[model samples]
Target chain A: MPHKVIRMERTRDHSSARRPVMVAIAGDSAAGKTTLTKGIAAALGASRVTTICVDDYHRYDRQERKGLPFTALHPRCNYVEIMEQHLQLLATGQPILKPVYDHDTGQLTRPELVEPREFVIVEGLLPLYSKLTRACFDIAVYLDPPERIRREWKVSRDVRKRGYTVDQVLAELERREPESAQFIRPQRAHADIVVRFAPAEGHDDTSNSPLSVELMLRPTVRHTGLRGLLAEIGQRTVQLRLIRDEDGIPVDALHVHGYAPREESRMVQKAIWSRLGLGDGDPVATLGDVGNGRRSESLAITQLVVLDHLLRAT
Target chain B: MPHKVIRMERTRDHSSARRPVMVAIAGDSAAGKTTLTKGIAAALGASRVTTICVDDYHRYDRQERKGLPFTALHPRCNYVEIMEQHLQLLATGQPILKPVYDHDTGQLTRPELVEPREFVIVEGLLPLYSKLTRACFDIAVYLDPPERIRREWKVSRDVRKRGYTVDQVLAELERREPESAQFIRPQRAHADIVVRFAPAEGHDDTSNSPLSVELMLRPTVRHTGLRGLLAEIGQRTVQLRLIRDEDGIPVDALHVHGYAPREESRMVQKAIWSRLGLGDGDPVATLGDVGNGRRSESLAITQLVVLDHLLRAT
Candidate 1:
């Protein structure tokens, strides 16, 4: 384990001592990590936010991993030391030659020159797997959608984009489950916010209805004005309540209804947008979109909420 | 002012004393009163639920109101006495001769027979305007969408369905504004739940984004298990928080996000369903729909939550 003081010191820039705010989004495969990061990037403007998939550190290609004793989820499957070093560099507003892993061909591709921007989002399966890496982010999020829903998403995505059959995807999921439990799920304990998109009760027709979102807001960072905002909106589009997390720690849980009408969502959005002092600019237009021409008021608001912490840090 | 004790005593039947659970949904024109009533009726089974639009109690025709001192929104513009009597009758599970007002032709049409079902839903502009009428309801809901959103809805609806020009509709809205303020908006204070629908901020294109819903759960009714359910699900779909109402009463406000996916909505629905002992049947398939083949998980859950209180009273 790395010393906390060392990682803490690295968060400040070496030259100017004014560090870029770093955010980490960790999740299992197909758990909506990139989707969330993408919306945040778009919301903050692409130039101001830089996104890096830390899975680029995979030590073996897909073909090599197949013959290895352990799965890619294990710490030994990647260059953990190098990943930690690069994270420290990025935290200090330095640049690095980051490795690349291509999912289509399942191979280690070309390395790329990566520079830290005003805001850096590190997303992948293991971004928060270790304390050293976790310390790199000012705000860390874990995407923990229900296992069944995640499986469905994985199968659909693999079939559409990776040319994989349902059977192959299922088999891969089984292979990954053990390591996921050992490595990925534990990272949630370290996250400032754990977000899950799942079906609400009696809504078994997940095929048509949108998934509702639950955000377990851990006490790692100070979340100001959210309680006041939830009170004023007085609608179910966004809710705030005190709850005990899995660790039995008292936390504020905010649930954003996915099937909420646009009208209900806007009130909460306005509350968050105003609180962030992002001014009267259009946060919903720029940040509210979640692709497929569908705009997620909650997603946009969540991004802004996360941005609130980063802005405060700056 | 009607005596509360007298009206309360009249709620039970005189003979067998088996009263139908009465629900009142009040809102301004085109504020989604019918849409909400339809979903609730569908959820509880249309045969089991009788819906009556109290706007049918208009004493004068639309043409007659034009020559009167006030607009249709005025209590004097409606047959409030007859409405109060019929509501009392319905609360005791009796039948009544209901008058009809045709919005399409703006005429006083033929009267019809109405028998109270197991559940009766009374929705209109002034269902909660009078103390006598308010006592007839087991649950009262006010559709309090944002003024601008309601105005947009009114313009579109009147232009398409009533064959009125946009300018004409706007003029009528302007004409009705004072009475709306005096009579309609105040009814919200008496409601157990004030539901608002609005376009999320930044999503100016209401046509493209789904409307969000916020539910103000007043303390007048004891909402059991909702907070526990929110904590257990650990999602943002259903959130409960302490809020101060317009009258400065501290209340528990539950917000149901409109853009929530079916998965998240289903979880909350199941919790509320089970708590209400609604059995294992599919309320989401029937009551969850918002129209045009869309299902609102929050709307469905809200219906069930209200049903819980009614059942408890029974």
Candidate 2:
């Protein structure tokens, strides 16, 4: 039919040009997805990155969900098909009038026009939930913070920022646990890199130390220069080890020590940045920003690794 | 690149399935596009038809456009790229979260979900404006009423239904004429069928008769069984002639007399409907409904001709 012929022609025309590199960072609510995405986009330069959250595909507002049988974490609560369609468009270097979900107001607001640039960072709970969406990404990352740390992060953020009481946030977290298990955590298996930020194991002074990061780098995508960089930087700041994953598959896990001196962590960051071929200079100052003028060297290093994958794909 | 490869695969998968047949009816504002689309959709049965207006792609609301240099009719005033992208999706039987423009309030309101069914009738100001969009339709129709008649229709509709003053409507129509000439009228050349409804030429009782229709059927599509059907209906009610179009192209012109008796028109409608293979019965009762309980035989016949083309393409 003419419909098929015309679409095939259009697809050929679209593919002849340069397309944007797509990166999906998926995790549960308050799992530091936004923080990780912000760091990567900053390092890539704001002008070259288009960042969007798939939570905007929510099929219901907060008020409507209160009466529903399932929580927002359920796939039924989202317009997953439209999400797939829009993601396909963005993945092909096209623009989309993306829907807006106002987290502060808990409402589905007016859509905004999003034009893909050199790179696109898609961060949300369901970015990697489907095969169609996962196919759109060149690099997929899943944030897997410890449950205790994540609960603390969620409580503090919701109370201070989202105008929710401590009890309400805790109750909602409990309500979402089952869907999180069924829908959110399973996406970890599809990611090329699974990042876990938590207090360092066997570290006695955890409260005074920053959260360390362990990146489980699967071989689906090449981790260029990562092993050599870790060796050069020394185990005092970062270490790489061969470990058996939960699935009993051998994988490389790179750990960035949170208790390491700031200078040592900066050295690790600098070494990774130098390999990026983005010219001879220090890394971007905004890479590790964690609000209120604070910075995390581990976060910066993790972002650099993700950036390296994106650039290497290009 | 993976982006190109993935998109090509997606396109192939989409084309392997059945896609919706798209029909575009394009014309200037108040050119009777919606009325024509309504009649065709009514004949096709509502369960199998999806109707959308492209005017919803306006980038600015009425208050915002008040201070702009151009009117809504200008190409730059609408999100033409997004419109093209969404049309490509719908043409392939995909759904879209379409934006809505509130005509009564002159505001851009929330978007709504639109899923394409068996037949999609896209009626609007610029559905056939671009090559990409034009490629999506199986049948492209341009409504080209005489400017005098169109202006009268616009003035009456705007003053009565849209809460516009007669003077304001006239002034706005004058302002839009240049853009309409530049951007809107040129699409008429791309249409497979050009329909004009106006007072019959040299008719003595024009005011007492409904508007007659002249359909210039181009050879881009096969107007199956039309000549034989017209011969059977006889020239007193409907006639076919070989005519040269504005571009000096030879085409078939079908004229339906507005003053033809209802019984004679029903015979023409039944002849067309029977050819559709929809079983032995009279044509649908709602084919020619105008607003406020009025019906036009000529309009019903024109809709039947379009329905014939749609079913033939299927």
Which candidate number maximizes DockQ?
Answer: 2
* Candidate of highest TM-score: 2
Candidate 2 residue-wise lDDT, A136-210, digit = tens: 889999999888888988998999999999999999999999999999999999999999998877763433568
What is the overall TM-score of model 2 with all chains considered together? 0.94
Residue A95 error, candidate 2, Å: 1.9
In model 1, the runs with Cα more than 4 Å from the true position are: A1-17, B1-314
- Please list the residue runs of candidate 2 whose C-alpha ends up more than 4 Å from where it truly belongs after superposition: A2-12, A202-208, B2-16, B202-208, B279-284
- Looking at candidate 2, what TM-score does chain B attain? 0.94
- DockQ of every model listed? 0.00, 0.37
The CAPRI class of candidate 1 is: incorrect
Separate clash counts for every candidate: 55, 0
TM-score to true structure, per model:
0.47, 0.94
What lDDT tens digits, residue by residue, belong to model 1 across residues B76-122?
87777567756766776666546677788887643555778888899
